[model samples]
Target: MRVLYCGDVVGRSGREVVIEKVPELRKSLKLDFVVVNGENAASGFGITEKITNSFYESGVDCIVLGNHSFDQKEIMNIMSSDKKLIRPVNYPEGTPGRGAAVFKTARGKSILIIQAMGRVFMDPLDDPFAAVDRLLNGNRLGSQHDFILVDLHAEATSEKMAMGHFCDGRASAVVGSHQHVPTADAMIFPGGTAYQTDAGMCGDYHSVIGMQKDEPLRRFTRKIPGGRFTPALGAATLCGILIETNDETGLATSIEPIRIGGHLKPTL
Candidate 1:
């Protein structure tokens, strides 16, 4: 199975880039499935139902949320009805949306995509490892599902890497998001699971982590609350990873980092 997991989509730049690039990538890469982290798609805060629908229409099979999962309150209205929309698994028991779901490709193969939020330097939610363990233990990778993808929306790189190693040999790929900066390390683990510290944000990189530089810089250098942080209006660099899993073992055979447009060096 070939899958592409995009990083957090910040704002208009991120949304435009994704809407423009996904269809082309899907055809060129021959992707069987696509998932995107959309926690920051709404003016750099949260995503809405409209944005989610745009993604689906543009070829996104599933959408995952992170720390700002509910920033756009309107999403909760359709959270229960939208099977393709996923939130952090560790979010309390009564969280609006699901954390994991099974999606079937055109070829009739099933892939389980799970999203978990890390507690280290993040929200004091449930233990991510424990939450993931329950799901991983319940699902038989090669038998019940053709592939399993875990998206750890975390702040600490250590936590992300730990999750990757923890789920080694069990999931087809373990990718991280929320940092908004693409890491150079993209490799398959010893156990055949693909790992990347961060897939980066599909937003303009010219600013401070996809935000307009003025506010972030003002807060950083002067340490005073000036105004709300907004997304950079420049063209965005779509960042993500493409993973190809073995059909029989349901393990990753290859992993590749992708960066296109904007300031980052193009990987294509």
Candidate 2:
């Protein structure tokens, strides 16, 4: 199973980048499945039903959310109905939406996608490891599911790394999000799981983590609010991680970091 998991989509630049490049990447890379974090897709807050629809039309197989998963009030309505869109599994009980799902790829293989939010530096939630473990209890990685992908939307790298190791042989890939900056590390773990500390954001890198620079800068220096935070209008760099898993073992055989367009252009 070949999967491309994109980072957080922040506002218009992020959305546009995915709409523009995903189709091309899908064909060129021969991706079987695509997972994108749409936590910040709607004006840098939470994603709406329309944005989710657009992403699906652009070939996104599944969408994941993070701490900002509920910023958009409309999400409460659409999430229950949209199986492709999942919220954090650890977001307490009866959160109105799914936290994990089993999806069939174009090739008709079943893949399990789970999204969990870290507790550190984030809203308090259930123990993510325990939450995911309950689902994986009887579910074998290669047999019950062709592949398993975990999106650990976290703030701490330490926590992300621990989760990767915890699910090393169980999951095919474990990717991180929410820090919004691509990390240099992208490798297949010793246990065959492809791991990355963060997949970064699918938005402009010219500003602070895809947001307009002015307000963040002003707040940092003056400690005062000047204007509202908005997405940067500059060209965006679609950041993500591509993992190719073994067909038999359902483990990652190769992994690579992807950064395209914007100031941080890639040769690939």
Candidate 3:
């Protein structure tokens, strides 16, 4: 199975870029499933139902959320009906949306998508390692599903790498998000899991992460909020990780960082 896991989609520019380029990339790569982190798909905050649907229409099979999952209040109700949309598994039990789901690829292969948020340097939440253990043990991927992909939403690179090692051999791929800067360490782990510390953001690279640079710079310099942060208007890139998994064992055979379009050089 070939799976593509996109990084965080910042705002309008991110969404527009994905909608415009994902379809062609999907076709050219012959992707079996596409999972995207859409926590910031709306406007550098939270995802809306409309934007989530747009991701689906643009060839995304599953949409994962992070700390900003609930920033958009409207998603609280819409998530109840959208099974493809997922929030962090480490969130408390009463969270609105699910953290994991199974999606069938066009070729009929069952792909399990799981989203988990790290607690270090992030909002206090349940233990991500424990949450992932419970989910995987409950689902029994090798027997119940053909492929398993985990999105480790985190701020610290160490935590993301730790989680990837923890899930090695069990998950087909483990990719990180939230920092917005793409890392160069995309490779298949010794135990068969494809891993990357960060898959980067799908928004403009010309700004701070995906927001306008001025506000972030101001906050850093002045230590005060002067104005609301807005999404950068420059052209965006679709950044992600591409993994090819073994058909029988459901383990990753190869992994590559993918960056296409906009100011970033294409990486595959």
Candidate 4:
């Protein structure tokens, strides 16, 4: 199974780029499934139902959310009916949307997608490790799924890496989000799970992690909110990881970082 996990999509620019490129990329790459982080897909805040549907129309099989999942109040209601969208699993039991789901790819293969949040430098929530274990033991093992992808929406790189190692032999791939800066490390673990510390943001690379550089710079240097952060209008790069998993075991065989367009150098 070949899966493409895209990094966080920021604001209008990010969505526009995906809408423009993904269809062609899917056909040319022979992709089996595509998962995108939609935490910032609206206006660098939360996702909206319309934006989520737009992503689906653009060939995204599963949409993953992070800390900003509920930033848009309407999503609470939309999540109740939308099975294709997922929020963090570590939230309380009665959270609006599901944290994990089984989706059928365009080719009809079953794929399990999970979204998990990290504890370090994040909201105090339920144990993510425990949540993942429960989900796998209950929904994944016996299900005739051919591919499994985990979106570790986290702030800490160490925590994300730990999660990847914990699920090494169980999941096909573990990709991180939220940091917005793509990491260089993309490798398959000994247990066959593909892992990357951060998949980066599909936004303008010329700015500060997709936001206008001036605001963050001012906040850090002067310790004051001089202005609101805005999405950079420059060309955006779609950053992500591509993983090829074994058909029988659903474990990764190869993994590589994917960075295309914008200011960053292209990667395979």
Q: Which candidate number maximizes lDDT?
A: 1
Q: Per-residue alpha-carbon lDDT of model 2 for 94-202, expressed as tens digits?
A: 7889999998887889999999999999888999999878877767898899899989999999999999998989999999999999998898889899999999999
- Candidate 4 at residue 123, lDDT? 93
lDDT of 1: 0.95
lDDT of 3: 0.90
Locate the minimum summed-lDDT window of 10 residues in model 1: 70-79
Q: Residue 14 of candidate 1: its Cα lDDT?
A: 97
When 2 and 4 are scored with lDDT, the better candidate is 2
Off by over 4 Å in 4: 140-143
Cα TM-score per model:
0.99, 0.98, 0.97, 0.96
Candidate 1, residue 126: the lDDT equals 97
Whole-model lDDT per candidate: 0.95, 0.92, 0.90, 0.88
Q: List the residue pairs that clash in candidate 1.
A: none
Candidate achieving higher TM-score, 1 or 2: 1
Backbone clash pairs in model 3 (N, Cα, C under 3 Å; residues 3+ apart or in different chains), count: 0
Rank list by TM-score: 1, 2, 3, 4
lDDT of 3 by residue, 1-268 (tens): 8888889999999999889888998889999988889999888999988898888898888899999999998998888689999999888987777988888888888889999999889999999999999878877556778899889999999999999999998898889999999999988989888999999999999999999999999999999999999999898998988899889889988998888888999876
Residue 176, candidate 4: C-alpha displacement in angstroms: 0.8
lDDT-best of 1 and 4:
1
In model 1, which runs have C-alpha deviations exceeding 4 angstroms?
none
